[model samples]
Target: MSAPADATASRVPAGPMARFFRRLGEGRDNSLGLLAILIVLVVVLSFVSPYFLTATNLLNIGRGIAIVGIVAVGETIVIIAGGFDLSVGSVMAASGMIAGFLVTHGAPLPAAFAAALAVGALVGFINGAIISYARINPLIATLATLAIIRGLGYVISGGRELVISDEAFLTFGVGQVFGVPYIVILLVATFAVFAWLMPRTLFGRYAYAIGSSAKAAQRAGVPVSRWRIVYYVTCGLLSALAGLVFVARTGNAQPSAALGIELDVITAVILGGTSLTGGRGRLWGTFIGLLLLGVVNNGLILVGVPAFWQQVVKGTILLVAVLYDELRRNRVEEA
Candidate 1:
């Protein structure tokens, strides 16, 4: 009787509580996989080029990725809400031009910066309103805005580059904090804020819930329209910030600056495992994704890969990431 009881106890499956904790550990392991990739890339690149492992080269790569990483955080938010934005690059150009023109006209940096950010928010508001209120698809709306904004950028600059002469503004671009680039610090701060918002806040959970299933979210009273608007607004504000950073780094704002940055931002977000179909993503994942791309680009230069070929490689990587995202989504649905 004692043997039978012992055997029966052993045969029983582990409790749901144990299984739950095990699954949580597995999820953590999945998260670590991203870090592992970053480590491997760093190791491989260091082997490929002696210059690649230098402190300056590493800092340069971080600075190089800052703009895209910042922009991609906003993109990650928008994408998690089940929408796509094609106007971010154009918005960056236009907003920076607004600031540049202001400085050209003798406006103070603070006032000009405020105006530029306000314009970006307004553009984002229009996008959100049109998508939610007018019921237009995000892709179509933003695509149209992309051209309109790009044209506006050209008109504002009069097809010329506005050279910023403000020493203070330029310093924001090249400055360092505790021996680390200011731009990298800014990127880190932005990532931390968004990470907290997306995973630890009520609004953030609602955003993800709505994207996961609009009908279900509606039934749950998630206020889908309101959150969507907030998402786009945040996107716009950050895009303007990114534009300013770009201008600081380049010391000029041209109509052509950030011409294809939206694609890169989107690509990084997708490669980070954010579902384009909506509702799933982590800010940290997007952070790593941007860094990965930055590392790749830097590695290419160190290895003497030509600029022309870099574009091709970038496109190929984007294609693969998108395809992988779609397949991953399909697998989740099937399961």
Candidate 2:
């Protein structure tokens, strides 16, 4: 008689690289492929443009996507934990406007900035509560918040762009630490911390557990509602951080800031190889994927691609990433 299939599979021995490839096939990692693609992209771009591989251009690419990278970090977390935050772009705009409005009204800079982050977290908490407790679909819930927050942004800014001139605040956008831009530093640090948390901490493990099988996790005594909310809150806070950074970099808070950024964030996460079905993905993949995105956009501009055509290219990449993930996963797991 043959042994049970599951038991037999459990006894199979595999080397480290073998295990990684197996998991890669299971939608657990895409960094290997993403890295290779990024390298090829860089090489090709370098051939087309003499400035593409220059120090200035490399740093420019890093700075160009720094804010998006920060937001994508948070989105990567929520996606891995089996949720989405479509409101991120709105949250960023709202938070930036909140800080801008407060600072302009004679409030202390620190206080105003803190308030922005607080509001971001509040919005996130609302999102989590709606999904985990109200049992609403995560997509629908966040999509609603996205509009609400953006409306509030318009109301807060009176539909005008607020110019910010505070030198301290502006320094983060302009200053460099040991020759690297502050925004890039923030991006790298954010990714590093979250990357560590996802694999080395209980919080990260719980995220995977919940994402992989919420029902099973609940049966094993995990607090599903609470943790799901935590994930959104974390995402919200980071979204807020990204917003502040955007305003600082651009030197103004526009009610319309971060418009259409949701696509960039989600596309970068998907391109990084995270499954829309959840319970899979890694930050390293997202980081590389983001660089790939930055390179493509920058390269196109250097080669004289029109703005509308550039947008078309972005949309195509996003579509392909989603299709690839869907084909690999085959089915979405129940929450």
Candidate 3:
């Protein structure tokens, strides 16, 4: 009897829940936690605001977040590879103004569009070059670019808004397929492309490796500088694309557009599980975070919350996200 009892005790195995929790602690299932919170929010909001679950309101939320959501994808890639981009908002303003100015001056729509994109890519390249090649810290370098780009935007606009009257271009903002706005489709398409590419491609692997330890990745033969520039360029292109989208939606280019938007993108990315220190996060997490923020904002509006209060809430959420990332990072280092 004693021998049988010992065998049974020794054979006892860890259950599925325990394994799940272990993986969660290791940070592999962060999206799962975020997903649960999203679902709970949906449930609560559906009850709190009678309009929250309506199709029109939901679509409005999608449209509201599409710009930030699109930008966040590129930002996610940058962050994962141990980089930062504070110039996204400024780039958007500048790019939109560039396109608007050109087209309004009788430049063909295609040419103006291409010009905007090229300018954005150039700005990104410069930022990447300054940081990666010139060895300036990313925070300081991108901050400088942010100021420079915003200044460029104002200079181009001459402190006046560019009124866009092109119907073809404006359609991109309001056009819909199957009752879904084209902008929303764009957001989804971006998410899908990145989600597939990030995990299954060499670029993705290199990004993670670089973020995990740039010195180690360099020793392992990764072209660290080249890839860093490429990532920033991609971010720039995406930022320009977002600017075009903004121009279409608003039918005008204001130098002030997208001001302070970078902070919002950073907030969404961090909330989605991307670490400020880099090397850990997912696009899906960012997507969920985007929706969560959108829904929360929409809910607050329905509940008649003040605009200033919304800013305060957003700031608090960002702080919490940073704290969580710091705590998790510390725990990982200890482990």
| All candidates in order of TM-score, best leading | 3, 2, 1
The segments of candidate 1 whose C-alpha lies over 4 angstroms from its true place after superposition are 1-31
Assess the local accuracy of residue 4 in candidate 1 as a C-alpha lDDT between 0 and 100: 98
Please, what are the lDDT tens digits per residue for candidate 2 over residues 1-335? 35698788778898888887786666556788778688999899989999999999999999999989999998988988899889999999999998888877788889988999998899999999999999999999999999998997788667999888888888978899888999999999999999999999978999888889999999999999999999999999999999999988999988899999999999999999888878898998999989999999999999999999999999999999999888777733321
RMSD, candidate 1, Å: 4.3
Tens-place lDDT per residue, model 1, 1-335, is 99999999889898977665654444422234556678999999989888898899989999989999988988999989898888899889988999888988899999989988997898888899999899999999999998999998777668999999999889889998789988999999999988988878976898799889978998987888888888898899999999999999999989898988977898788878788888888888888888888998999998899999998988888898788677666766676
Name the runs in model 2 displaced over 4 angstroms. Answer: 1-28, 331-335
Better of 1 and 3 by TM-score: 3
Q: How many backbone clashes does candidate 1 have?
A: 0
TM-score, each model?
0.90, 0.91, 0.94
RMSD of each: 4.3, 4.5, 2.6
**Where in model 3 is the C-alpha error above 4 Å?**
1-27
lDDT of 3: 0.91
The lDDT per prediction is 0.86, 0.90, 0.91
